[model samples]
Target: MKEYASILSKDGLKIATFSNHFRSEKGVMIITHGMGEHSMRYKEMADFYTNEGYTVISFDIRGHGLSEGKRGHTPGYEFLMDDIERVYAQVRADYPSLPIFLFGHSMGGNLVLNFLLRKPNNIRGAIVTGAYLKLGFEPPKWKIILAKLSSSIWPTLSQPTELELDALSRNKEVIRKYENDELVHDRITSAFFVNVHFAGQYAIDHANEIKSPLLVMHGMEDRLTSPTGSQDFASNSGDNVHLKMWNGLYHELHNEPEKQEIFNYEIEWMNKLLN
Candidate 1:
């Protein structure tokens, strides 16, 4: 496995990207990570894809990981999609002849879906895991109204402090590493949450317009985004969609113990599509 780093200039921001290539002669898989996390967490998956004769590329989206910007905040909902498009352009320029696949997880999944709705022809196919089509927390109607108001006045207002320990209790090692990692942002802003909620609804409203072949995956035991989001996406994405739900996996299927099985399934699916 080999790793490389590059910087992408998007919307006047220097975004950092980390990539792993297994075989120099194979297709490319571009990964987009979810909220609060960076691209480095995907090293294992990148290596796995590389070993399977694929070049894997992932970038730290603005406000996450080693990328430039405030942690957990976006200028607007569409800014993240712009970042994805810029990164895709960079990867495509380098490997113009290779088949390209987009893989996104969590908030990354939401971004991929939104991208597809707007630019369906950009990639060969896409895979979304633990996507947030609908959120678990159903804020009151008034709170939603207030959040929007607050965003304009105080876009950077800190949100409910996220407890990584509470969220990752099942994986003590991950929690330990996250707590010690300075790059990971544990706190979100009010505007970030507001934008995410809007994005979630927007994707749901336009899911059927997606034209790319899609593979959607979720863990049955996932408590974060809920498997319902994947279910909704798969059901509405028309005939070009495939759905897989792991019996005991959590939100991060790639980090689960059965990740190898899931990874193999995704690779096989993509291989079949490319062929």
Candidate 2:
């Protein structure tokens, strides 16, 4: 079922929160979305999980969606963490005893991995797709230095993400919808760039710190986030971390042609953890 709420973020921002709950829920999931996108794109995934008897909750990361903040901008990383924490707290209070899992895509995956280090011991497991632990492609070092400096002087300065939309998925219809989506935009702020860059590094440094059952999946062809990073994390991380790689898929696994196949794997992973 679709439900909505106004979440008061710790930094006093009004966040637009959305939830999809199944009648006979076996567990709950809190999803964090990628940068430059809102929470609405995950409605299909949320519905799928709900139908599978899981309640999924998510919010627009501060500046991106119906949330109250500057577009494509944030105060810092801690502020972003607080926004996710608010929804996490809400789910815990309401569900109380239900098993909870954390799910993330791209930038959201980076956030989920970071939170795992904080050791939210109550969570059952986590699922990450195309997470931004390391960029599949590298930007010029000069450009990176410029953006970092711009973040300090003009934190709200926005620039095109230059994301290759074609790399998202092979589904023509989904690509068409994404291209024409009003809420979807290419602008990303300097502050967001710096924060996520640092957050990505932090996730790698503390990969072994993740205690919860972890499943990290990435499309082998994803040009945004490196699949090798996911592989390395799973290889070096504690025994709980597992990695799944899709042969020909791109970054947006949920939007891919074989999404159901991928979903089946995710469900199986969750079920094992739930058991």
Best by lDDT: 2
lDDT of 2 at 133: 85
- Model 2, residue 124: displacement in angstroms? 0.5
CA shift of 41, model 2, Å: 1.2
Quote the positional error of residue 147 for candidate 2 in Å: 2.0
- Model 1 lDDT per residue over 97-198, tens place: 888899999889988888888753568889999887765556699988998999999998877545334343256676677678777776677788788778
Of the candidates shown, which would achieve the greatest TM-score relative to the real structure?
2
For candidate 1, report its TM-score: 0.92
lDDT accuracy of residue 214 in candidate 1: 91
Candidate 1 CA-lDDT value: 0.80
Per-candidate clash tally: 0, 0
Per-residue error for 45 in candidate 1, Å, reads 0.6
Segments in model 2 whose C-alpha atoms lie over 4 Å from true places: 21-24, 119-121
